[model samples]
Target: MTESRGQAPRSGLSYLPGEAATDPDGTLTAIGRSWTWILGSAIATLVPGVLVLVWPDETLHVLAVLIGLYLLLTGAFRFVTAFGREHGERVPGLLVAVLFVLAGVLCLRHPMQTVAALSLIVGLTWLVSGILTLYAALAAPDLPHRGVVVGVALLGIVAGIVVLAMPTASARALTRLLGLWLVLLGIGELVFAFAWRAALRRGDALPGAAGPMD
Candidate 1:
């Protein structure tokens, strides 16, 4: 039987006037196109994270400098990716990027003080990064493997809270935790990058759209 005019489709796919249409395929294609940037960002994060973990015996000053550089580079990469050809929304990425940069600068300018307040600084950074990542994962319906992204973000938030709750923790412990978190985050991104590549090769359509519910 023919449906009546002005009625919603039986499939339940409905869109309001002036709303942007869902483009699952386009979204996937965009991600595939930006694989290089994504992979680079992941590598950039992973390398320093590994260095930090392997050289745990380093002095507090060295630790501070390394962490600061890591944060700074990570932030810069994120900022670039947000404005790059592949990213969806710019705001969330921008906010995360700024927080990372600030945290890095703070560490560098006052290395001694940073070591003294390592827990607070690292905790705040993780919390902020996690929140932003969670926001992006949920908001960007076009993002592939969103479940994994959410998982990673939650890990970051939980780790941050744990560190903050124990402000008196030793510098060595905090450094280790931070390194582990960065490594995990990097791995997550790498997974996402490869997944996107695979999907693109298979010509898979990512579910959801940049528009309102349909």
Candidate 2:
């Protein structure tokens, strides 16, 4: 989500597609209110991260498979979320989805990949997604809860950097680090979702906010 509900910042949303914010004229637009998919994306990430954390003893192969599944699911979530954006804004979401899917594929197909290889794939995806998300947040100052959006983007950027910089010696070590970041990312997205929901509610209660949804 370059702007809300969708990116690698992708599943929990390294980007939202606007990270679907991009609401012009200071009102909550349809896309701005799309918190459901955001929640779905968060769940996709949180579950996998939690699973990895709980099962750190799992082999590298198992870790790869789990990560692969998370990426694929995130890709799917991002893909659907892309449509919530303006046509011109769809490209970023679609791009993130592709990146996630490709990474997932690589992970699943080659579970025996070295720790560095796996880290490289995931880190790159997150880095790119975070950059896109930051771009969207900067470009759209009017985006609702812009501060939260920026915060999430920064978290993603940091997560990417840390993972790339600290390729752990073993699968267990990597598992702990990745799980922590994923959980943090998921929490960020979860907050964004509820924030959007609250904003939508407030907007609906406004004097003339019902026109778009109808």
Candidate 3:
């Protein structure tokens, strides 16, 4: 049977070209359906972040292990989203997933590595993240709160540069900074998750909501 224009394909995996564009919700995908999981992950990230902050004296090995776990979880989430029945571009997601998984594996395998090496890894991660954020902000001219995103991207870039420049900084200080950043990131994720959920609810009345996985 010939599929009508704007009709979902039988694969039930993706939308027809321009289908998502015509949707009132912008784009309906498996990722949007997984908002609750994303929200939970965001909240889960806060736990270790808080613990690290409260116990700054924790051993470097312990901190490394915690960070590894966090990265692993983050990577797993990204991988799922990358290969899932999402209706948007997946190249960036795939790249990020690979980076997170590799970093997490390295951290886990070398928990006892020198502070300088670990700092370098963290710095690189932040630098890459900042670059990606800037790219995204520029790519999406219609993105809400574009100014705020650009500001955050700038801060991320500066933070990455500072960390790289001061690789000799005390391990405890670096750990504290990492912990603080994680906490803030987790909070932001939580807020975004809730907002996404709200938008999904509001979009439920639209035709896109009837799409597969919606």
Candidate 4:
């Protein structure tokens, strides 16, 4: 017997199979589910923030560890990217990779010292990034979400200033702030996931089938 045209066919291991391949509508609907993920990210950030607030001493050590880990990862990524560049490319990618590896190794070797040295360096970097963000926000008023850019820049600037003025206090504050941020973000992600799931269900509940005869 032939399959009924009105009934949507299910393909194993491939719920979304042929013809309906370019499921732009479905894809967008699925993407809507990602709000939960984004919210989770925000919530995760709050953990460190809270740690900084409640236990400043503990925050320092944690921050040091975080910095070391970040450096190691950065170095690895830089090295990989450098090597991944075109074989015959004249880019100084190799040099950059070497620099990154060297930095990573240094941090790993003297993780303790990195707290003082790396903290200062990272603070400066944050300051620069914050300034750049502010500049971009100001220059590109036409951008769709200029407010977000500005807000991020402002936050960065504040963080940088705090880190510079009172490294220890800033570290603690940052930790607590991060904790709170994470909690909030996690909730947001959960909400988004539910919303996306609901929307998809609604869309699939359309009335009036297109008649059978496949």
Candidate 5:
């Protein structure tokens, strides 16, 4: 089935079975493209979570600042990554990046906001990002390792729901819960980064695949 012409189209990095082999230099170009930005995004998320957990005594102000930094850094990484994706598949990644930046700005602007406000900001961001990612994966018929992508998206959705549903009366509680979820989400994204890299390599190894671009 063909995509409707009227629709603007959904986008993200994806490749189909044997697609790399058939496209001249496309597979090589993709393989040569560093997937490290995803790794960096994972690290950006992991560091803030680790710090929040380790510094449990830190005030709400400190926590907000940390989260804001994390979001901003992640957004930057994702923005770079979005550009690397095939033209038709860049929207989801770009949107996610923008969302992170917006949320980061909010966190940084009001670092002194109460626990509920902070949670709401983070929760809604995650939930919306997750939905976007999941939709893209499902909509992309040729996406490789579809399961892994779906799994990562599901993880984020679960984290968002948990954070939103659980009532946190104090900074410490939010710290613990949000910190744990961040770690989990980071790990999930980390795994996804590696998985996608492996898939790209496999695509390049197929018969008739082009050599890596200079």
Candidate 6:
């Protein structure tokens, strides 16, 4: 339905007068289009996972290099974003940058230790994060993005388990496992991104001057 400015559209859907009517058809279409990007990200992540699984030994070294690059880039990004922001405190971003820098430096210093150390650190982080996420999911099943949060928790649990279960593995093996976890996470993120992109597109297409839902 076409919306007239300062007037409520048909359907009386809003409690407040003059609330716009949403165009469901257009919104859905927009959302679908956004999902295409997410799908692409998922495919990219899956490729790494497959390679790691197929050649665990060779993948381990590659994993270390990839992780180093990831840490460096991520840290730089965080710093840049934080510095660019005018309102928020920079401590969080600075701390993250420091951690990433440290990780990268350590990786360089002891390339052989890269995999084991990374596996331990990543495993612990995931374990804690997973528990928190699972708790949140259970506490608020109706929460938006609940499914994605739950999926992340599950992935974290699996990643943690894999790392802890093979602590004795060679550094190469550990690195490969770490890569596996990352690939899985990347896939999950891609999926979530697509879902968000779709939702955003749908919201954009909706008629009647729709705004974000609380």
Alpha-carbon runs more than 4 Å astray in model 5:
1-33, 204-214
lDDT tens digits, residue span 42-146, model 5 = 888888888888997888899899989988887777666654445556677778889989999999999999877888888887888888788767766556566
Backbone Cα, N, C clashes tallied per candidate: 0, 21, 0, 26, 2, 3
- Per-residue lDDT tens digits for candidate 4, residues 1-214, read 0121122222101122231343434432222122233233334334434444456566344665554554344334333332221233212334433443555465556656634465554455445545654654454333323454355556656655655665555544544443343234334333433442333343331111100000
Candidate ranking (TM-score, best to worst): 2, 5, 1, 3, 6, 4
Per-residue lDDT for 59-177 in model 2, tens only?
A: 88988998899889888777666555555555666777788899999999999987677778888888887777776566554566767777888888888999898885566676788
lDDT string, candidate 1, 74-146, tens digits: 7776665554222345567677778889988998888877444866887788787788778767875555556
TM-score of each model, in listed order? 0.73, 0.78, 0.71, 0.42, 0.78, 0.52
> How far off is residue 186 in model 1, in Å?
1.9
Error of 4 at 16 (Å): 22
Superposed on all Cα atoms, the candidates' RMSDs to the truth, in angstroms, are 9.1, 8.7, 7.6, 13.7, 8.5, 10.5
For candidate 2, what is the TM-score? 0.78
Model 3 Cα displacement at 1 (Å)?
27
Backbone clash tally for model 1?
Answer: 0
Greater-TM-score candidate between 1 and 6: 1
Model 6: per-residue lDDT, tens digit, 1-214?
Answer: 2222222222212222222133233333222223343344345445656666677667445665655555554445434333311122334435545665566565555555556676775575456545644654455433335577478668867777888778789876675677677678667756665554444433421121111000
Stretches off by above 4 angstroms in model 1 are 1-33, 84-88, 114-116, 203-214
Supply the global lDDT for candidate 5: 0.67
Candidate 5 residue pairs that clash? 11-89, 12-89
With a 3 Å backbone cut-off (N, CA, C), the pairs that clash in candidate 3 are none
Model 3, C-alpha of 179: deviation from truth (Å): 0.7
Model 4: number of clashes? 26
